[model samples]
Target chain A: MAERRRSEATRQAILDAALELAGEVGYAKLSVEGIAARAGAGKQTIYRWWPSKGAVLLDALLAYTTGPSGRIDDVELPDTGDLSADLKAVLRATVEELNDPRLSAPMRALSTEILADPVLAADYADRLETPVRELKLRRLRRAVDAGEVSADADLDVVVDLLWGPLRTRWLYREGPLTKRYTDRVVDTVLNGIRRW
Target chain B: MAERRRSEATRQAILDAALELAGEVGYAKLSVEGIAARAGAGKQTIYRWWPSKGAVLLDALLAYTTGPSGRIDDVELPDTGDLSADLKAVLRATVEELNDPRLSAPMRALSTEILADPVLAADYADRLETPVRELKLRRLRRAVDAGEVSADADLDVVVDLLWGPLRTRWLYREGPLTKRYTDRVVDTVLNGIRRW
Candidate 1:
């Protein structure tokens, strides 16, 4: 029990240090050596726990958003039985999270890092993208099962449809992702873009 | 006219070489030296023409896409008076261009470059994003004017919504973007995500 506790503590310390440094210097500058020194752990500790810096950073971010007790499993669109309301509530929360200065810098940096470095990119996709996408897909499937969405709706494209606009906005910093906008997206996507 | 012709030829050669090298070695490996060598032009010629690597690459890409037509000035979304077909036709053409092997690699590399490098990111936004956005916005406004879409619909976000899913699929290299998916996105954004 004591060894397990110590291991967990070391793991958290490494993640915390990685997140802080990734935020400060950007993901391009994030190094295992730096993270170890900051976390006061041996470099081997980070290597043992995570395969790469991106993996460490992904875990740190997942931990930051979902918290220790909270899992991605808990991060679902509420089935409050109204699809629109549920989607709006979730998206509004996402708007807040995406806009948060504290989170955005690190996340963007991490994204940039993965894009620039193929090794990090692969690790990020496996550790981060898969889980996030899976969770989102699961939530969307639930919406379909509840007969809230069009039976003919392709969930994969639908997921991209939901995420793509938000990504374009977030990536380019083009405009605001307002509650009004999220509501509009939910409305437009459900109804159809045509004037029928 | 002879001097003018020589200058134009040199510029096109440089751009062609840049595109070729960017595809072969990846964007990070591409440089003025490489492009000049590939084009059989002097390094000074490249410097005399463009300010930065990012600038040169994007110009090369723009030239490749637009061909000898110069800028797409007279280009307007076909207002065939049938809004859905017009939008889908434009979008399908865009989808084809995005998926084209010649364009996709450099475009992806450039996007990756922008994500990693802030300076390049701004350059990309200015060179590529702004014009494309304006073009799309004008097209959407035309649809509104023709009474195909509600005037009150948020045009900017609507445009993003329409293109965003395809982009997400494109960026992630997730799935094949077929006409079926394209039509679905159009229908979804036109209507709404809800089942009535």
Candidate 2:
């Protein structure tokens, strides 16, 4: 029991160190050695848990956003019965997250790292993307139950339509991710999905 | 006159070499020195013509897709009188471009490079994204003139809604870029934007 507790503590320290170093130097320049030094843990401890700097950073990001006790599966969309308001709020938060200076560098690095490696991309999809997508689907289903959307509506496509613009703006840096933009997106999409 | 022709020829050779090298070694590993060596041009020559490897690749890709005389502005969407058919045909071609092995790596690299650098991102938006966007907007305006779409429709938002899904899937590697998917996107978006 004591050994298990110590192991868990070490793991948390490593993740915290990784996040700190990632924010400091950015992901491309972040190294395991730097993380180990910051955490006051040995190199062996890091290697024994995570394979690479990217993997460590991914885990750190997940932990940071989801909280210590939370898993990626625990991510939830708002369900205030007003679909437009709920979606705008969620997307606004997303825009904030995307635009956050400390988070943006690591996020960009994460994307580049994922693009460069197939294994990392698959892992990210499985661990992060799938869970977030499922949560959004669940919220949309609730909206359907509330009569905010049609029961026959293709939720998957709707989800893509809702998410695609924000993702494009964030990834491509094509436009400002303002609250007004999110509101417009939600309004336009709801016009299509809402029952007449 | 001879000197100008020779300089243009050297520029073309460097671009070809850069494209060829980017494909062989992947973009992350590609270097100006390697490109200069392969093209049999001095590093100074490459520097005089293009700013970065990403810039060279971007130019090379434009040249590849548009042919020798074609500029980025020359890219046009189809106008088949039926909005659905025209959008799908253009999107299908886009899907093909995204899925092409020869183009995918360089494209991904270009995205990463653009995301990392504000200057490159602005340049990409100006040189590539703006033209494509303008062309699509022009097509939508034509649809409006034909009474297929409502005149009051927010063409810019409509454009984002149409392009977002494809951009998201290609950039994030979230799902397959299939013909059926493109058709579905067009159908759903048109339902929102078209005149009732």
Which candidate has the highest DockQ of all?
Answer: 1
Residues A114-173, model 2: lDDT tens digits: 877888888888887888889999998887777767776677888898888987877777
lDDT of each: 0.78, 0.82
The TM-scores of all predictions, comma-separated, are 0.92, 0.89
Q: Candidate 1 — which residues are off by over 4 angstroms?
A: A69-71, A116-123
Scanning candidate 1 chain B in windows of ten residues, the lowest lDDT window is: B69-78
Model 1 C-alpha lDDT versus the unseen true structure: 0.78
What is residue A40's positional error in candidate 1, in angstroms? Answer: 1.2
Q: Give the interface-residue alpha carbon RMSD of model 1.
A: 2.0
**C-alpha DockQ of every model:** 0.66, 0.39
Index of the highest-lDDT prediction: 2
Q: Locate the minimum summed-lDDT window of 10 residues in model 2 chain A.
A: A187-196
